[model samples]
Target: MTGMKAFFGTFIKEIKLLTRDPAGLILLFLMPSAFIISLSLALEGTFMTVEKSVNKYKIAVVNNNTGHDGKNIIDLFEKSGKLIVLTNFEKTLLSEERARRAIIDSDIIAAVIIPQLDKNRDRRAEIKLIIDPGLANEVGSFLQYSLQQYIYISEIARLNIEKNMLQKSIYPQTVEYKANLGTIASNSGDFSIKKYYALREATTDIIPTSVQQNVPGWTIFALFWIAQILGINILGEITDGSFRRVKVSPTSERIWLTGKIVPYFLINLLQVLFLFALGVYLMPKIGLPALEIHNTGALVILTLAVSLCAISLGVLFAALSRSSFMLSSFSAMILLLMSVLGGIMVPKFVMPPVMQDFSMWVPHGWAIDGYMNVLVKQSGIRDILPAVYRLLIFSLLFFSAGYLALKSKLGRI
Candidate 1:
């Protein structure tokens, strides 16, 4: 009975002390809210543009073909508005050195080098486009298709003029030849010129509504990890004779530990709830999909599991550290390292395959993956079983280690 009473007395005293400290109060409440609001605002302009623009490619054309046809093709390309041409060349423009320098300086996305002459019997000019492989395949493909179309049109026009002259010479009595001056027709025949032009001008959607819906999960996990640092402070109390006094009283140690963790867990849970609420309310204002509250039970359960895991980690850190300063520094390093390696700082898909494989071993990665599965993927409980099981296992391991550490330290004192 005395042990139970003493534990409660210590727990209550700890709570009062935390509440009295302005820094603790801010860390518990205000800091999390500010982080969420600031991050949301910072990401607002990144992917939510109303007027989308297709990226225009700058192409350097080196026409070494000393023919009128080559100049006409170059003129047609410049008039297309799809390419920006650079053309001040004192020497051979298609030389290896010139093309390499043009690409290095970012003066052009690609360079078209028309060979001086065709040595082969085919008589087709050797046109090679030197391109930056780092550019999107779409841009590179667009330039190739445009060049092919120009060559095809020039050949077709030349062929038609020759056929007209041949007919006039073969039969002097034939009707006078006159060119049809209508707009050029599409080679594919499936689309008109107007439709092709419109399609070329269109842009693809870069970011999706579903991606924005998942942002709350990221924000919630970040706050959970940061708040877990408080566990170190709890460990400090134990080392400094606080837990020893409680052990002599009537309160159960188990209940006292529960009380100590409950406040921090609730703080994390509240932060998750606030981020979700803000996402639901403000997503529509920014032309994003409104947060869908599907499977609220699943979301709640997942959030609870994540919060429990974070608290367990905190407890483990506190029990392991000898002093408050050491605990704080160690917790900060752990949190930062986990956040970076676990995809909190960068998306997992963008990471190298090796890093992606390595992240699976980290607890934060499991937590983030589980939350994303439920919130973004709209997965059911059964789908997230593996992640849930992993988190539960980690919580057990951390809690057991923390409990054993606390008991051992108390025994020594």
Candidate 2:
């Protein structure tokens, strides 16, 4: 038989062998879907939880003012939609110890003590706000904003009331206005207030959800899981004399590698589609927000680029690691380390600044960033070109390394 026929025959045999391996099929397909679903479900409400914590603030009001200022301050807190006023606290729990305990226990987020303002001495009110130190800076910021809003509105109300009272003091004097009214008459053409309606809602191009990140993340991980299978296949062929037979034939190493790679590449692409489908459809059905993609074309390009990188890495791993044990161990270490660096285990935003910068060195980093640009940032195809180019470069590097490793292995044989 010709070398091309042998290559095609070997490719068919390998595809059949892979189809028969239940564990490999499960690893490639089911595991990633399950992980994406579980992690997405677990992390779906993270943002909402933080938002709720920030919006619903329990604030204790210690009103000590003798006049209407105390009542007005308390009224302001009561009227606020953001703050839940915790009243009767001063009478029941007068000690600062109790207030501190309340804050420590998270029963109340903050305490606003309205001290008796000496209207004669101080121009501005000295309102003391005791914030929960355990909570992050965001809590303090929100509390400050709420108080400022109240103060602004109250000052405006006071100024308007004073203006009204002052206006009442002066009787409506038509005598002065009557003299200038004739001279003030002017021609006004189309003098209309053009009331422009502006939308108050903020527009975001892309909103990243837990699912969009995790689904692609685990899918990338599972794609690299192909390395173990590739290593096993390469080792098995050598031990069984298939590699010797193929080596002696007219078929080139390139053709043999291509045959092996094509099947896995197609499989990896299918795996990505399955996970993305889960993110797009199944997740939303289960009440989790579906993955939002701005450019599906960009996503497809990224998927293909990442799959090629993954397959090439598998080839390099197989060529270097001659034994199944060594392949499994090295592949696991590499995948885990890359996943961490690539922001698969943890989101990139929460990672240390150094790690965030270091992640760019890995192909997975480029893949996830590209996916995020397409999915979360609503970036177009042009925006993701850098990531795709980096992935291609990594694929080229891995393939080159695999060729060198294979040649070294063959020379020894």
Each candidate: what lDDT?
0.61, 0.69
Q: lDDT tens digits, residues 226-333, model 2?
A: 766776676667656777776777877777777877888888888888888888889889987667665789888888888888888887887888687888888889
Supply the TM-score for candidate 1: 0.56
Lowest lDDT 10-residue stretch of candidate 2: 189-198
In terms of lDDT, the best-performing candidate is 2
Clashes of each: 12, 0
Model 1 scores what on Cα lDDT?
0.61
What is the lDDT for 372 in model 2? 70
- The local distance difference test score of model 2 is 0.69
The positional error of residue 307 in candidate 1, measured at the CA in angstroms, is: 0.7
Off by over 4 Å in 1: 1-14, 44-214, 226-228, 286-289
In Å, residue 380's CA in model 2 sits off its true spot by 1.1
CA deviation > 4 Å runs, candidate 2 = 1-4, 50-207
Kindly list the per-residue Cα lDDT of model 1 for residues 135-178, writing each as its tens digit. Answer: 44346677677767766775586667667878888886875775
